[model samples]
Target: MSNTLRISLIAVASAAVLAACGGSDDRNDGYTPPPAQPPVLNVTKVDGRYHHNKSQQDSGFRAMSDMPPSASPAAEIALPALDAQAQTKAQGDSLGGPILIALPQTVAQAQTAEQLASLLHWRQDAQGQQVAALRVQAADALGIRLGLLVQALPDAALLRFYPDSKTAQGYETTGAEINAVLRLNAQAGEQGQAARTWWSPDLGGDAITLEIVLPASAAAEALQLALPSISRRFVDTDSDAALQAPPAQRAGLSKERIPSAGSCNLDMSCYSNGSAERDAVARMSFVRDGKGYFCTGTLLNDAIQSDIPYFITAHHCISSQTVAGSLQTDWFFRTASCGSPYLDARRTTRTRGARLLYTSNVGQGFDATLLALNDAAPPGTYLAGWDARLNNSIQKVLSLHHPNGALGKISGGETQNYANCDGRHCRAATDGRGRYYEVRWGDGTTEGGSSGSALFTQSGHVIGTLHGGTASCSAPDEPDFYGRLDLAFESGLKNFLAAAQRPF
Candidate 1:
């Protein structure tokens, strides 16, 4: 039994790493965002998207499947938590209404398996005989995907949960807490927007909840229409909903200013003050450590098939991540030199960025994203001036990042070693998981706020994106890892520019 309930945070649509070997904590593929408390997987099968928007403390590794009935996790087969809370807030005859739940993970498992599983589990009941076990075959059973649950709820009806809500004054319910904050009087559009997700964990199992929710509007009564169609009834509108779709986009791409070091402006890389609510409890601060924050990208807006245009970023930076039923969100980029997000608007000038576009649909798991927008490259920004190469790692590349929580950390030469690999999907890893390049940078390594930093070569070329660094600068490990920039974007990015550049 889980000692406590942990709501799943954000999840990404595609996994960064593919576990090709026997799955375990050691060799199984995973990514550690930043250090915080180790994540506790109280339950195994919850569902929610992981948000790549903010700096985070990632949930460790675990293996999963791709199916629907399995879409949302039940509280039954969950890992016990490191902490504890009372279970079964309400049970038995008292079970009914839009349940407020925090699921372990969410996966859409078809009902066939559910029916078979239910039949197999059927046995003697209270009277020593098995009566018809029909809840497993109920009305709301047909629509078992995680999104269906959130979609079923009216936008006016809010659902929100805090993964950090573990203390006494913290939580009201488990999973994504749906408090019905701002009731939007939503109407079904001409065509209800439809979406499907193939998610990867940022935290652990996904999470879901609907306890104190608002009601639905008459126009969008799809959940009501489909609830009756469910034949396999084990699923319920009354019981707790497990890992549902992530509630927020979470990670996003934006721009910041790079200040020259050793000048009147304290010597650092780039800087920004943005929201950390998605990564931690509130806001966080970070700075550069090794060669420090360094990077460059063509902040662009170009024509696609004659009409669209966009600005692009590595997919790992903007893609949504999934977890027990939540999405960790990162809306802006920052460095340690900066304090909490948004000190003063004048201190940091926001860049022209929006609606990220990516190439996940073409084949599968390509790490590329485009920020579809209405404007061309802003002043001081360059759009695609180099060769977007592919599949070849080399030595001696230029590094750029926002350090000390400020800007101008790039322009420093740093040689990095090819550490471990996540899989064919994500190319690089570090012994420090953030310190692969530390073998070079003496004290100028990346700090807390340098994630999403870019690295280039001396000849002025793009190479990789900064992710992690040693636990600290003085640490023994050579902690620095980067996302290689090559492949797919060469073409996919061009297409996005054609589609995204438009009149707002």
Candidate 2:
């Protein structure tokens, strides 16, 4: 793509000068001159370190290999106890937490933004690519425990953060702990070319800090600073749930920690086929009414080719608009090595919210929900293609998902004949009971976090999203069900997913 910005001011000035000459015949020569072209502002791809910190941390940072030994109590802290209502009242009616500030776009603000970028101590990966970093301190001068929120300029393609070296070594942190205290970054999504807003985790003390990172391609003028409530910082890990570790205490899954018989480990290479299908899968984490939960989803490619960040997941997982808005999405969370012991923790990308577009429950015979993410997927992320044609069934089927919100996992199976359940047959569900594709897995299995995962055909096109199933590692022969994509398309999804306009 060309990085040119055209300005026509020079042409206008020349025209004014010509008019001031009073149309002299000697200079006119009875001929009209061609219009002058506009001046283009050249944009260059920048790569290097940029931040406000003097130096970068070399050690003490926790990587993805540090997952918890076991699940913890889910309700460690109650939602109401976070004092959300009190904080909101104190902020005087602002909904984006206690602190929210619009980013400055003036030339003066751009200069300061550039200065801050220059302060960043950039570091390079093994591939020699530079990454910008900023150390975010959790506490302010007043000793108040708070989480800061900031809106980025509209040119940031991708951004993420991790525990700075000093903070990482202070305690045995888990992935949950890192997520709880420092929510990190947000990047451009499918709908927009860049991200507009971001927030920090609410940490009540000096115990939590982070080093925010962004791609060198980001424009310095786009960075903005913001601060929000302490409650915004917590991951909402209530103790009643099965997964227990705090967000900060966990990391990516290592080889030994991968489930032996149940969920397929993301480290397994069989799941990845180098297609957009692999990149389209994402793990979904959400907090509603002070409780956190996990599910899976896929980025769907639509007819307009707008890259609008349209997403599909199980209606059972998120049927309400409120829960949909509260969602937090993670992308590219798989391992670099097929059977390696460690996953590169730094590669994962995240966003905090989305908009609900459509939804239906199992009783309605079309258990599915469609969403348009508030933020676009990061650069290089995929928007998966779909096949919503009724009566189309492939011999082999596959699924990629996050089981228990752990890591990306793949499952494969053979499609048996369509089975009728709740009075609907496969490939036909309207007015009848819901129809679904039945499959018997060849290996691996799905779990709690796997809900809403996309079911793909052998050719890589998505056919449906997981609805419910009895199949598991302990019961390998049992069958699993997926809501038919054709049904979803006919019911209203066609208006968005279909490439051609067709009346419903």
Candidate 3:
């Protein structure tokens, strides 16, 4: 049969199934149906007209030339060597698990304001701003992330991290931005130690220099900065060459890339279809418990089709607002061409951080988390549509994800049945009762970093997000489960996705 005929049959079959299962009124367990009409999923790219207003960065920034040389070299703190055996074990076990990269280490000294001041290399810029610098060294590390416990950070204070002090290239942030994220986390009931700390992004290198710039009026003692801990990355998941190295050469191989997904996985570029779906997906890298991890998330289009940068991912990947605040997304993280090994360097973009809007626990039912990105998505990105109708039925499904944190890959599958699944264990559920869609892959398979990927229906509308399952390259016939988007829509997602709420 033709593809069009096959889809028509599937839809008719679905309508019949819904009617048999109790019709529209009783299809949803106990929740009210959405107010808007069913989504239009035929469009390839939702236009950028609805894109949210991009926030402007702080202006009047001074370059490195404005600052004078430090009176003395900053005191250095050296970190311990990475455990090769532990890293190998983590990599092997990560296939069906979280993408673990960094290891936590405590700062032995200079945690307090007084001690930090003593160790800092103090200087004054041409503008007379007080500048202090500190160096952190971790031999052979792929990257470094610092955790700061701030008591009070003045509005005028600016923080910058760089590999070299002479050059201008570095990550810069204001105290207000950091404190704002922390406040959001606290409001979301994230009171854990991780929530209390503001994590700095990982600047690739073995060592990094931290520079704090304060107005001349503010004294060194005025700043209440504490460095309780830092995370040192053992793997380079974000690098373009991460998948080039062999398994045997991976251990302690600084130049050699970390292994990618199994060879059986299919690259997204290999397919001509699903261009919009590919643009909507992103590779998510985050820090939790002082360890770096990766997952996948998709940009979602709301009822109004606004480009609010609303995102959806697995609750398991980011259950709390604190972890959401730590999210860094890589867009257009695919190959340069069809079946090409090299990445499209010009098209790739990275955005930092997001605010957690809503989330449902795994134990509760559907494992999903919604977020509003802190920055606007890059140009040419798409906000994917979703189907939340209770009567919606998925026949053929597709998943676009970055497995093993490498380049984006696509997997094709068919929806088998409704199931109640937690990780690998799955059991059949009564009609209209299951929280997940049990899927069997025919082409590619999901791996470690594929968690939180969107499950797209034949018409290109998302119906679910990837939850844990037993599917892999070794067991292609095994099933994978995706938490139902219909269930998620009923439980708080409607507030943002539907037209019921104020414009997001």
Candidate 4:
């Protein structure tokens, strides 16, 4: 837990720096320190931001929310249409589209060693003259050769290319870049055939869009190699017509009208015990304030635990001064669970469940909180909303909550994306998912009655807390309101999980 992290450094002068980046599994790979040179040139270490050096470490950035900027795209290339590729490449497993790799067209026969040696800056001559030699320093760096290509430029001559960088192919620059490198190599090959060397520094342009001709042979094999690296997620680009709304609709919620944050609908739901029979509700007694019973404990599963007991209930329902009739020790969680019978006459007559972790934002705060189970919950019972991989991206979820005077009663609403708050307040958009658009309250909207209610996504992702609403739910013009649980509870959440794994 106390391990250190190193910094990262990038050399603007070389594309080779990228080799080390994607080159190895080692987190420490990718960067090479410059030889100690001048006092002025010495690399001084800075905090948090990527230093691109192995020495500085990852601890800072690993936990940070922001990332550094990347390099700019290469220059665009222009060319005359060439012949159709020898044949369309045989399609292999696709990485959506980004992982495709192949060679560019080849205009002529192979280049002679004499021509290659003359054109490339293979080595420097002792007499101060430049001598031609193979410029490649490493074989792995050459990458898998895809097929070839040849294209006629509006201004320049034709050329060939090679592709790499698919997870299957295992080259660099995953997708678009894969296409780029191959085309460049193919062009270099074409020049080699002509007995010329030293590719046009710009290769006509810094980049090329190879939607056209390509070489044959190795292209398909190389494309197969890049399968895994290709991203499968697909988001269609908007149609051009959608770009221009009818003049009248232009003023409506047009794409231009939508902010990156967009909009949402909200609904709110409140639950409370209604039965007048005091003892009847006590059977499921979780907490009893003068008004009524808030909740009764439910058993939970032992999975994902670090030797601790577990169970979940509303934060306030556990023990809220506003809700608990009395500040009695018996009111708080004593064991994993208990019934209104008060565990029989014998002080120890009650069955002891696992330790239960509990979560809650201040009553004035929200429906968000955490519970550390003293021990795992009883069999068959598990936390309803949880996904470690999905720390905060829950798309659609709903929660089950118990309100005062209600034992098994439940209240919940669809969760919305977390809002950015300047201070204690957080805002979000919503659609009529649940009760998010319900609930009348000035205590910022979600009334104390609705406090500690669980708000989840439709997909069961644990999004945020339903603390309160403004305009309709929390405030008008202001989106729905909820406890920024993820952010608010972020500080020690992971630490708690880690500690559970390694105990004293």
Which candidate leads in lDDT?
Answer: 3
* Residues 201-262, model 4: lDDT tens digits: 10011122111111222221122111001001111123221222334422231231110110
Residues 83-188, model 3: lDDT tens digits: 7887788666554456777777777775665666677766788888888877888777877888887777887888877665343325677887888878887776
RMSD from true fold, candidate 1? 19.7
TM-scores of all candidate predictions against the true structure: 0.34, 0.51, 0.81, 0.27
lDDT of 1 by residue, 430-484 (tens): 3423212222343244443344444544344444444343323443223344443
Highest TM-score scorer:
3
Candidate models: Cα lDDT each: 0.26, 0.46, 0.69, 0.23
In model 4, which range of ten residues has the least summed lDDT?
Answer: 14-23
Relative to the unseen true structure, what is the C-alpha lDDT of residue 246 in candidate 3, on a scale of 0 to 100?
33
lDDT of 1 at 28: 9
**What value of lDDT does candidate 4 attain over all alpha carbons?**
0.23
Q: Predictions ranked by lDDT, top down?
A: 3, 2, 1, 4
Q: Where is model 3 poorest over a 10-residue stretch in terms of lDDT?
A: 16-25
Native-to-model Cα distance after best TM-score fit, residue 44 in candidate 1, in Å: 45
Q: What is the overall TM-score of model 3 with all chains considered together? A: 0.81
